[model samples]
Target: MNSSSPIASLTKHLWSMMYYFVRTYIWLSLIMGISITFLMAHLVFWYLDSEQLERFVSSASQTSQQLHSNLVTIFTHSNNTCSEQNLITMREDLWRAPLIKDVVHIQDGRIICSASWGNLEAGLVLPKPTIVWPERGLQHWRAVKDPIKGDIQVNMVSDGAVAVLIVPDNAYASIPSNYPNTGFILSTEDNRYVFHASGPMAPENVLTQSGSSWRLLLTQQCNTSSKALECVTAYNAAPGLFGKGLWFISVVGVLSLAISALLHSSILFVIHQKKSLKRALRRAIATQEISVLFQPKVCLTSGRTIGIETLARWHDKHFGHISPDIFVAIAEKNGLMPQLSRLVIEKALYQASSLLKTDSNLHLSINLSMSDMSDPSLLSFINDHCSGHRIPAHQLIFEITENSASGFEGIESSVARFTSCGYQISLDDFGTGYANLSWLSKIKATEIKVDRSFTQMIGDQDPYNRNTLSAIFQLLKDLNISTVFEGIETQEQAEYILRHIPHATGQGWLFAKAMPIQEVARFINTPNSSIQHNADAAR
Candidate 1:
């Protein structure tokens, strides 16, 4: 039967429609199931982030008040005049004050004595304070460059008669490195951001007044015997796609994907209960009843079909169409994945031979199971098929799901072996499994396919969701690895990905549906195919 004949075209069109319908339902189910998972995870993470901020601010406030009490005690007990004995007393007090670098005596707007330098040979004339607390007669000189200290900057706080010089760097020694975004500021009780030793948590202008660019996490007000000070902590609360909120986003994202996968598996489980799916799947693979379809992966920037992913479709005469998920799971559980994988790879390479010969740049991506990765003969099996089909190994991309790759103990070496033989390895369904960031280094994948769930988040304005996507994209970009986004169903999603990740490629209904080999060939050969037209339209 000629593929372009009316009957054949009608059959192909019907198949395409059925495939689209089934896939749409599956994706919708997956999305729906995962929505609750994400919502719950987001709530949990948000609570944690807020709790952490509150705890940190509370601790900072307590520490500030304690230090303030100690400073006041030192000032009240010391003599007002710059006496020889008084200088000795100040020097002794320095041994108990860890945060204070030095203490100096001030009289009539002049520095007369210091702890480091017992008595000044010539009194250093004091300049006007940067900030003044008239209520407590407190004066603060912030970030003052001192010639006596080799021109190093120091913060000076005084109560007319005595002063303390503090190192700005030492002020934040208690903050942990993990909280990189955490910032601290000292403000007066009147909500005025005082130029204190702790310095401004955000930009000077932003700290001076409330602005949308920053978010105040929490504030703690405490009395210091003389005056009241507020301990302010905040972060760059721009509500960006990714920032400090990535923790919440990633947690939600991972759980959502897990729920989606579980929902898909449960659905397939219920469908295959009436029949012996494992037996049917085994027989289908043996009789080669399963067929392969090619889905084009289009370059977001160039609007070109760069490659195709080979998908397996099984239509059992009695049971009707069986999803690849069901059949593939049956194959894996029944120790038939090796055979199924080999059959699919052999067919794909052979079928794509002519396309490969015509265009060297075009690659065929094939999914590999844990069984195949562990099989020592898998490499030779693929190489033999490629050799017979006249297709170069470089033109073949072996995609391994995160779950499969993580399950295999020696996946890194297995993947490396294939890559060494010129086959490209792509981490498929990334972020949908329990694999951590270290997994990428272990597998050394040439590319990563961003999960459809993540693709669904492209246009989401939620801070956590945006941050999660941002973190994922930035990590891939930083790794300098190739990325492909899957399940891009809308023009808005495509544009969002392209705008953020300019070099990425994507596959979804918006570009083209999975098609038969004949349609795949025509779609690839057609210069102005609908895929390119859609891509252009999207741009």
Candidate 2:
């Protein structure tokens, strides 16, 4: 009887725990299921809305580029500036360019003549523009009230020769009838000026307000061209999971509650299944998942793109974006550096072959690790690849880090061999690692890249840091070695480099970020845009 009683008590205890567990699980599942269903519905609507916005922005960008191209054509054909014949030509262009409402001749910050208003007696003095892009030689005004047409405002863009006028509302008048709550706004890259806006949301509200009810996607449009602007497309959230009936919601809620019991176990399984870095990297190399990007180097005095440095980039489905430093270190440790370097070189040269052929002066730079310099096969591989691509050896600059140069034995001879083969060598990241000055004297480098650590010290109040920078700059100048000031991210840094090293080139985000191959082509296409010329002229 005592043994039976103990068994009964143990069974009751187990039953109670199971009952509580089941009850809790059921409640949690019900709650999570409802939440998930609502989230899924919202995602569906958001996806649809984003697609619509993407199409709209793309169309607008094409239209803007077309208009700018036509305007450039008008400027090219009309040799005379603001003359009677030029005015006639402008009027004719206005008729041909459907997007352009009118054409105005601007000189010395004043409207001298126009297609609509033939000529002004003394020229109507104009106010300052809302935004200016010195690099592209472009300026724009968001709202200009017409003197003759009472209360009508027009948008204007000029290249210091002729201005093209556009009716702001006409640009965004194609909003679909179904998307009643959809809103659009076009602004400068810096968001300083609103070029156009439409729908229920005002430009001011769209820019200033941050609300979950409105989902906004901002895209930088026409950034690589003269016609540069940013587009913002908004969609107001639909109420209650896009109007799913109560019955549907209830059913989904019940099903989710039932399935919630297995969710924890499934998540655990997924977590354990994630691949290690080595395994993933090996797979990436095998699948050719690595990509190459280009960072432009601009002449400090002219702000013209002079060269581009190739950068290896990788994105794994599970790992997202991996930094080069991490991947490179892992590759070296795993005896995969050679393979990785070859992959990067192959892709970069292939992608840049056309651009290199077009511009002989535009050099393509590739970075090499210490191991790469040590490998005998590397030089031959690169030479063969260059020959295949028809790229000149002199057009390729091999960039080696300071550590790589100092750590590697017989690096000088390696560099000399490369130079003898007509390739230029650059000592990159000049100020970091071991602080050795012997490598500078030993290696015959064509160029030296001042590290960003030094660039960051431009505005330092400490006299010691300032003097160190001065000495470094003076040393490079004394060596007569071509120098590239890396990480110049601000106007101050650029100005400082310009003041100290007038002949030096710069590479950084202030001019442009590292972009894809296509953007590089577009950026190099316009040599006369003169970012620094306008700045100098303004001064």
Candidate 3:
């Protein structure tokens, strides 16, 4: 069967579809894995943070109790009066304590003494000053506004006396505020009386002390829940869950990528082995079990077949139809490129012999390799074959791939000799490599085939140059060098090339993909091949 057989194309299309499906699944799995990892990380961090806050509240509770014990010892030992020498000593002792503001004593519901103010003179009425506070425990906490300094005092009272602690705002130094956007709200468990209230909107999450009357709230330092959770988990989370989640995710991703790559490689290996590419290639060449196909290159202005590019095809027993590139690669690796090239050239010349005789203007294009060119007897071999087939050298244009044309040192001289002997040389796949302008200046071929990349850009505005191929064609015209646009797969691509370079030739699926040699006459029978400007220029 020919390389252009419908079955071969259908197989490639099916493989492409399957590849897309598998690629999409792989991407989805990758993304899902990452998301799950991060979510789990945040959850872990939040739990740790919550636990840390509970411990902080517990510390606050212990501190409150210690203050309670100190107040109890001081009140009962001084005969409950300001004049006691011990009472004066107690006041002196606590006066400079950081947590204490003042200590006051009451006798029979009358204001009797204040530690800092001494005895009340002229019988200042006490009137049982209001003490409404949260009932966290048997002890009482009262908040009273200070008039002059405009600060508040929180009083911790026992059965006998009241101990005034410094204002919460001034005393917050005892609690840590090290975390970002996160602070603690120091208040009673019920929140009825706030010792140091975390400002409004401070705590978005809360935790209570396990064995105490205090509540600790995590404030709004964290904007998102993830950040908040991370902050909480990081509170006392020194040397904690910081890098554990990332490490787990990295291992998962690396293992997945490795496994996926291995799986794909194994599948491709199976495909390659089942087809037995090396063996099939040898069999195909030995028995000439291959078909020759030709894709017509039409003149843009005339819409007539000016030339046809030769292609070879082989149908495998197991893999159905394989791509030409695969077999060609196998041939090169096995050191059979010379034999393969010679066989294809001979077949193309023989199969198209009658067509060449019928149309004097038509030429056939055949790709040549570096090995074929480097062979000293290659020119003679081709001439002998052409002479036997009665085909003129001018009618067969040898196509040299850009890469093959560049590396060979004496290639330019050899190619020049071929042209001098009535044969034409073409630089295939032009503008797709480093050899475009550099090799063009050095080697100088009769024709340049603009590679598919440039053809694909036809009728499209150049992202960089803007003028793009339009400018290129104008330069070609000035240089009087013929141009052939390759890989014009759509009618729009065809129209774009024709409209811009009407004198040039084009070969692509639009005009005619490669077809069996037998189908050549059928296409050529109609001189006007119904090519029109109907297709929009490709953008």
Against the true structure, candidate 1 reaches a TM-score of: 0.49
lDDT of 1 by residue, 361-415 (tens): 9999999865587788988988888888888888889897644434556777878
The runs of at least 3 residues in candidate 1 whose Cα sits more than 4 Å from the true structure, single-residue gaps closed, are: 1-275, 402-408, 527-539
Question: Superposing all C-alpha atoms, what RMSD in Å does each candidate have to the true structure?
Answer: 22.3, 27.1, 16.3
In candidate 3, which residue ranges exceed 4 Å CA deviation?
A: 1-275, 404-408, 532-539
lDDT of 1: 0.74
Off by over 4 Å in 2: 1-275, 402-407, 434-436, 527-530, 533-539
lDDT of residue 474 for candidate 1: 84
Clashes of each: 3, 1, 5
lDDT of 2: 0.75
CA lDDT, candidate 3, residue 25: 61
The TM-score that candidate 3 achieves is 0.55
What is the total number of backbone clashes in candidate 3? 5
Q: Give residue 420's lDDT in candidate 3 (0 to 100).
A: 77
Ranking of models by lDDT: 2, 1, 3
